[model samples]
Target: MSYATALKRAARHNPAWKAASVFKVAVEESGAAVLDASGEFQYDLAEDTYALRDFTQEERFTLHQPYDGDAALTVITANDPNSDHLILWEGQFHKILEVLGADALRGTVRYRVKALPQDEAVPIRHSIIL
Candidate 1:
């Protein structure tokens, strides 16, 4: 099997990875933002600094991506997350800042995201207001 395929399989079967949902934000006529579920995916979330150092040499070499100090990194599989998307994880909202890296073989996508501000993260019946 290709390295990309193997990597995806490992991430899928790994118990450490968490399941999450992806959402797209839409603005209403009243100028209020609402989150709509777009897709589902699995990810391994970690502090950017720790993840950078913890990643294997092959993984780092494959990514060739850099990140900001305040950003958190999430190694994701299954769904492609856009920069404008928001992720509902651990009962909180995280805004995707940018895609750090994408495997050339389409195995995974690494994203840099930050927890949304309290006011912007207000959830009403599972939908968030941006």
Candidate 2:
């Protein structure tokens, strides 16, 4: 429904994410020179709401390398999910990447991603945290 909702869903399997902060969202551009128009995220970690900042020319390309390009979110965690043993949640974004071939969000890609082992899902509320 919303980015906040998405994060909450992503958090069920990642309790550490409960305190995680979404800092940035970078997309892959088609021109090969990552633009800054695709979309940006407004984060309120304490409340768990990540909204689109604005629509613009998406940024892409890292001339330094290929495949190294990634659509990623910079996160500040309360603790290292892996080291803390709370990183049970597997990342499904890669699945989308696999299906889309790493260029799905070219114009604007919309899809719902679910965490594996469905049972881990829990109800979440929108609020600003972290």
Candidate 3:
């Protein structure tokens, strides 16, 4: 068998690689939208079509100033090509900034993601009319 196929089989059967934890991967799409009834606009979310897979947090560390904050490195098994892989973990969104994989090791890929900045709290002002 080919090296890529063999690597995949090895990783899949590896006991250390747990398949319990689940996470969502949002694939970026470049296309236009569609118009529906009442002139409402709609687009393919692709939330339902994307595959949910197992990933393990290999490492996490803090980043000093002049750079963004904390970051997490994870390992995921997929034969997908090198591209941006958006991840939704624990209600927080993250984008795969880097990917490391080889053709011989097709099903195993490492991703480094930095958490996207969340919405800031808006202050409400109450003015007094004298």
- Which prediction has the highest TM-score against the true structure? 1
Candidate 1, pairs of clashing residues: none
For residues 1-130, write the lDDT of model 3, one tens digit per residue.
Answer: 7554455456457755433212332212554333345443332222211112335544544466354643444444343544444444445555567664333455445555666677722111111111
Cα-lDDT of candidate 3: 0.41
Off by over 4 Å in 3: 1-65, 70-72, 120-130
Model 2 earns a TM-score of: 0.19
Best by lDDT: 1
The lDDT values for all models are 0.51, 0.28, 0.41
Give the Cα error of residue 37 in candidate 2, in Å. 41
Question: Could you estimate the TM-score for every candidate?
Answer: 0.47, 0.19, 0.39
For residues 1-130, could you state the per-residue lDDT of candidate 2 as single tens digits?
5443554566557644323222222223452322233332222223222212113433555578765433332222322212111111132211112211121222222212222344543212222332
Candidate 1, position 63, lDDT? 50
Pairwise lDDT winner, candidates 1 and 2? 1
In lDDT terms, how accurate is model 2? Answer: 0.28
Worst 10 residues of 1 by lDDT: 45-54
User: Which residue window of length 10 is worst by lDDT in model 2?
Assistant: 80-89
Give the distance in Å from residue 120's predicted Cα in candidate 3 to where it truly belongs: 8.5
